[model samples]
Target: MRGRSRGSGSFPPAINTKAWFIAAILAIGFSDSRSAMSIWKSAHGGVFSMAIRANGEFFQPPVQPICAQPTMWLAALSHPIVCLVRKLELLVALLVFVMAACFFIEMSIVKPPSKEVIRGLFVPSLSGPGATGDTIALLGALVMPHNLFLHSALVLSRNTPSSVKGIKDACRFFLFESGIALFVALTINICIVSVSGIICKNSAVVYGVALLACGTSSTITGTYAGQYVMQGFLDINVKQWLRNLMTRSIAIVPSLVVAIIGGSSGAGRLIIMASMILSFELPFALIPLLKFSSSSNKMGENKNSIYIIGFSWILGFIVIGINIYFLSSKLVGWILHNSLPIYANVLICIIVVPLMLLYISAVIYLTFRKDTVKFASRGELQMILSFELPFALIPLLKFSSSSNKMGENKNSIYIIGFSWILGFIVIGINIYFLSSKLVGWILHNSLPIYANVLICIIVVPLMLLYISAVIYLTFRKDTVKFASRGELQMILSFELPFALIPLLKFSSSSNKMGENKNSIYIIGFSWILGFIVIGINIYFLSSKLVGWILHNSLPIYANVLICIIVVPLMLLYISAVIYLTFRKDTVKFASRGELQMILSFELPFALIPLLKFSSSSNKMGENKNSIYIIGFSWILGFIVIGINIYFLSSKLVGWILHNSLPIYANVLICIIVVPLMLLYISAVIYLTFRKDTVKFASRGELQVPETDKSKVANDSDNVEHKDQLV
Candidate 1:
């Protein structure tokens, strides 16, 4: 009894089985696949607003003038304002669903006749040509594949007995509970469908409320399901609100873009298209699940019986058959009827033919693939989850780059660029996650924040130092680090010119992607993203430098000296960049590595002065360093010194011993370079020990032209849309 109580055996057969989760991950956990499948759920937010507007119009009194912004409408109903847009919609959606659920529960019990209920439950009819397609959407909506992961996760919450009889009993009770849940869901769905079918135009509020509830609930639940999938498959537990925000933001952009372009009709089309995609994506999830369920080696005593397996496979085959039939018919009809250029149609055929074959082959392979993992111990799982230094980065770089392995399916240029950007995002997220964990550990030890900061002062940069080395090596020719989506700005500004500018001279060829070359729309979007990044970075960089010069307390002579150095240097680089960007012919940003080395030398030039000024009370006034920050500043100073010493020592020793340049020549090289190196070290040391010598301006002594002040304020925010570039 104690043993049974101790083991919450509900999930032991599923969650505890490594074979199950691993197989599931392979089926649906790839970044692109999961995101694609999630779009249908995301389309609802736009439709929710549409529904609100429609309902708002229906309830409007003849006396009240119409508002252009439907979202901002104040409906005549004073109490429950029909369409509460903005922040209140989510709460409104919740209320709508609750009220609808109660109404439906009572209706299902009292209104619907038993005969009609049973017939509707038991029988499905192909009433028309569109009926078959609607059925597919129905199946997709009802049998959401991601829910399998969510269910397994949820079952872990229950404390079920571990004993054989107890396990069986627990399964039966869970099954009954699930049935009850399904019945309630079905009742709600049935009533909603019926109401829509009836088309009660007089009661637009009813339908609008229904839509609001649906779009809000679908997105909310989908985001949660994604959260669980990430937790279960990848063991990634992102904060819930953050995860929701990310998902909704992703949804909003495409939806809003479509709405703006094509209006209500376009949004409706998008929703339908998303639904179709969701329907087709089901087999990818279902086949693998079916494969796992039928295997006694994986599921043990819980494996599906022969009868159940036979029935399930037949159902699976039917769904796949319907998909294939409809897809082939649609493609064939489009191919025959479309009035595009012959070459374009041929291009479409070339792309579509192989994809169709690949899809068919994949379904067959997933069905037949053997399940090798029956169990995994804790250490094995841990090792698999947290990859070591080179293992994670190296293999990805190699495999993606290897022509022999990927062949024609080689990574797209944009994909390669995006991967490099995402690598930095992953690094930033991991740093934050680990730092938070470190803080918790310090808190337990009683001296939390200061000690944590002190430890970060040592540990974080060391981690960055080595992690950066791997990143530097892994992404040599094309490295972009993203902060927001636009941080791919760096990629476009630098690496993009390398990727795209050279192509202007060459005849456009499809050899690389072959029929999968960028469409005109994609090419246009890429150009836009590229230009926005370039223009914004250029604008911001110049503004920042100007601000630094104008705002600083550096001596007038020093400021003049900086302008002398910066003006020509900026022109030289900017001219070179423009030449590279617009030139018809190009080389592969020749000696990119040497360029990196040259830029590395410039790092201390920026950091030393910035640190020296930021740490000084006179320089920054109230913004000057606190003790915690002062300690961090010293640590940075030490690190910089250590780096400089090692760099100089390594070069000096190599030049003296390794390079057998004639002895006199070697001596001459060292004599010439060593003094400049010493000067650099002397400057660093001087900055490290320097006291604040500059005086702060008196309260009213500052002088600025009124017009110039407004210009600065306006210029600062002129490119606010490009905040992501920062």
Candidate 2:
């Protein structure tokens, strides 16, 4: 059991040896574990990355800034002096810390924030902008999981008791000490944030010095961390000088690469990026620590109590979630703004996105991997039972109501009703929280207003559409898009317009009611109004389907599955629309506001017909649909349709290029979708170019009588002349 707890004790130290261990640590830890080291060498080398981020983005320049006039101390600190400082890392770190500490002391005496401001740093703050993302990112950095590695490595130096009781006593003291340490760390972080709240004249020099201290300190500590990881992971020791030299050399690689590729201005940008990468990998390290600490086999009687386990898991997940958020937001911005060619950006995504998914998969595996469970301490058992009430009720109620084993004597309506209501209230609260977070993101984001509205148009409605019936909104990924609920329900929306257009066309015709039919002016206005409605639908649909296919975060297979299912349905929908438009008979239609009902399906039918009917002289008299109406209607329809086609085509091409699908799958997709597309074009062309065979039966009118058409035109001319005379 103890052998399983740590691999270090099981291996012979001599077998691996110190040099081999150092080599391995350079390979593994510095791959990303030494991300903290990247900042150490890169930022301490440049003195820029430790300063504040403005508007949730890291802003160190691409090149290191050079001063026009150098200070005496700076001039003395040549490349050789810097190299010496890097070598004497501990001495340099302590010296910088002392200098910074002395400066802070002087600042405290000479110029300090008001007492209220100092007091506020310790207290909760609600005054931050609605953009809580950057705040969370900052907090996540301050209390990092990797920081635990540093602490854990340091803890090995202290004497820990072997007995379970003695360890329990030690844990009590550790908890108190940890709280104090965190409080101090948090205070310092807040102080830095507050100071960074405004930019000042001396920002470069003042913050530069502060940044230098931070980077040096991190580097010094990280050197110890590398040593600790080497010994623990490989059961070997290396000389301190050799370890430090190897670590520094490896860390300098990224810095040198950035300096060469991006030039001097982008020097410290590597450190900022490395720091973000560290955040991304932070949860992977934490998941293991949590699992091991929680496992009975590893910790035995000293294993975390249920409270500690629960609390630690929650905290760990929060950190993970923050990293995911940060990664997503940053990745999106980078891809959008990058100067690289589309294919290059795409190549980057193909490589990076899978690696990210793998990272997440690794974390999830570590977190949920089953471990041996044993009896909790008496106090832990009692505490668990006491707190179980709130969490227990929902499942208990669910099982009682749902289980068929209970027969007719199962949970009554009252119990079900209460449980459902309680559940809804809880869900509603969570939805509000989620919405607020999203709204805040959109509001604070760098996107334009139209883009923001586009996001809301896409996200808000889908959420509203699904949230009502979703059993578990946040807990599961597959809620709204089920086989029946998703596939068939999606089609039903398109089918509805099948009922509507006929009812409108037939009722509005003069043959159905010669005197009752709308006047020429009223009829003209109606076409224009419908044209706008169709235009809006086209806008909404393009934003939805295209954006969903291109930008959605769903797995690739899920997207491909959706494309496969929906392409066939869309073809069917187009065929139905073409048949309906030319079909002699009509069906009764139900009409209502689309915003209040299913819309995505209706968009295709609505968009297709608006061009055909409004431009056709046979539907309305030639006088009614003037050149303006025909031109506007056709322009809007074709524009929308063209945009949709372009987007879908581009997306398909991109997907085929980047998809994990095999060649056969790609060939199959192309075969299916391409033919369906050609068929749609044929249907549309046959609909558009086909001569009309059927007439309005009830109307008993073969096309508007020539005399009536001439009379309508004359009436419109007379009305226009009267308006001009007036």
Candidate 3:
């Protein structure tokens, strides 16, 4: 990670590299010695060691190296120079901002825009030649992909709260801060655009001064961004000064070349080209942020809400769509204008088309990639502690019990007995908790007797299989190897959605909880976690499915079977999970009212079922129901149902409009989809109005059936008396 040192011994290599780079630029810029010498002397205060002849040649220095002294002097000053540059970067940025403001104000005074300018800002329009190019440049300027990576890494420098509430509060604060910053930036941009529109004449001097200040500050920011990007993505740590130097040098060479060849206009064009490159690269950065922020695995309970997820995806697609359109139009225009030979055009298309496809395919892949990083949390830490504690307890207990393993070190009789008792108690509690949850789920499901029997039969074998696997893992020779544990955990974690989705559904369901319903905090947090898990699962599943379908060498029948069977089954499974997430809660306990109020707007589907169940006499028994709650729930349910219908219709309409289909095909789709949608709405309305049929005795009144009286009584005794069913 250490950079090239500035010591006298290390000086030659560094100096030579810089010297060669400068000489190469000079060779390109000036063929004559006098002109080159004059320029060199003007820039560097006449510090050249080699003598320049009248002709365009340099006299070779002696083997003793006359240039060594000045080169060494420059090398010694390099570190301090970089330190100064780093220190000045902030001041330069402030200056740039101030100067930009001043310029905008001056321009506004010189030539003001009308009210129509405001309207134009809100409403996008392309007019005249090069409008698309101008739009591309504007997008490139506003959204630098690398800046996102820089910001992501920069935020990590702050000490973020580990708790859910703290994380949420922090997110809000950041959002506010970002909003303010963006507002200021937007104002500045608007001012610039307005001024540019009003003033037809050039103001290069004013613009250049501001641009130079901006570039100087941006170089520093870019250096830091590059460093963080490397560290975050590649996990490569390098010295900051070295990174800055290398990056600046690389950037300088290209700019110098352009300046020498294309002059100021060429340099300006270079900036535009660079901006376009960044614009194209924007999706790579944006997609990952959207994916990670919205991911449950990476963000845990801090993942984005449904609204944020939807909004971000929409914005992302809009930007991507614009870029695609711009690129395609440009490509088409270029091809048409060039009037190349048919063979050459065909060759160009062959190369470019596949590359474009690859670019699109890559974007699609990135958009769907699962966030695999498992953010550490208190619960996860507790789980790890629980598992590890048993191992430690078992070892200690065995050692204390055995006189052979530790003769003199062995505990006294009472101590050994106490240790064994504690160990047993810990183990017992773990087993009881696990068994209770499993049994609860089995008992709570509204399945038929045959289904319950089948479940038990299947579970028994699976339980045995799990026990065998654990035993094998424990006894294996390589079990203690920890090097690949991270890789192993990542592989295992993909399967976690299976466990997580079910846990969320069951825990959040009052019908399944008997008398021990989850609190509002737990339910809310669990749902967020559940959504993230489901999203990641879908991302991974879809990616793998697509990949397999594309790459598989299976027969057409096998592929068709996969498409018809596996894909549909997966879709159905997902739909069932989603439905369960929205299903009823029988009890109206804890913070149900507060949760209903908070989530009713965003998650009407989940709240609707809960409302229906809680309002039902059969479900809530004799529990008092507030008239206000009942009324609000029904109103909210209807609104939600309406919103869902609207969303579905909009999507269907959007699909129909976007695709180039015949009139009959559009008619056919509308005919088929409209009826299905109506039926769905009808079913939802029916469910909302449906009355509960099952009646349960309140409190102590036992009204059990004859066949299950003993079993019911036994189960009731184990559970709370309030949880007893009639």
- Which one wins on lDDT? 3
lDDT of 1 at 639: 84
Ranking by TM-score: 3, 1, 2
Output the number of the TM-score-best candidate: 3
lDDT by residue (1-726, candidate 2, tens digit) is: 121123243223452253234334433343322333323333433354344333322233343222111111222332333544335444644645543563454345335566766677567565654333445535545555345555555444445666666567666666775786666556556555555445333343455455545554445555655555666556567766666566655655554455556643354444444444555556645665677677766567778899989998888888788777766776788899989999999999999899778767767765665653344687878655543333555556655665444557788889889877876676566577668989899979998899999889999887776564354432433223224556665555544556655655565666565467677787677656654654454455556877899998999999999889876765676567556556764443334443333453234456556666665566654444678876787677567656656766887899999999999999999999999767755665566566755544335544688899999999999997544322
Decide which is better by lDDT, 2 or 3: 3
**lDDT value, residue 295 of candidate 3:** 67
Candidate lDDT values, in order:
0.57, 0.56, 0.59
What's model 2's TM-score? 0.38
1 against 2, candidate with superior lDDT: 1
lDDT of 2 at 720: 71
Model 1: residues >4 Å from true position, as ranges? 1-123, 127-129, 376-726
Q: Rank the candidates by lDDT, best first.
A: 3, 1, 2
Instruction: Give the 10-residue window scoring lowest on summed lDDT in candidate 3.
Output: 1-10
What lDDT score is found at residue 427 in candidate 2? Answer: 57
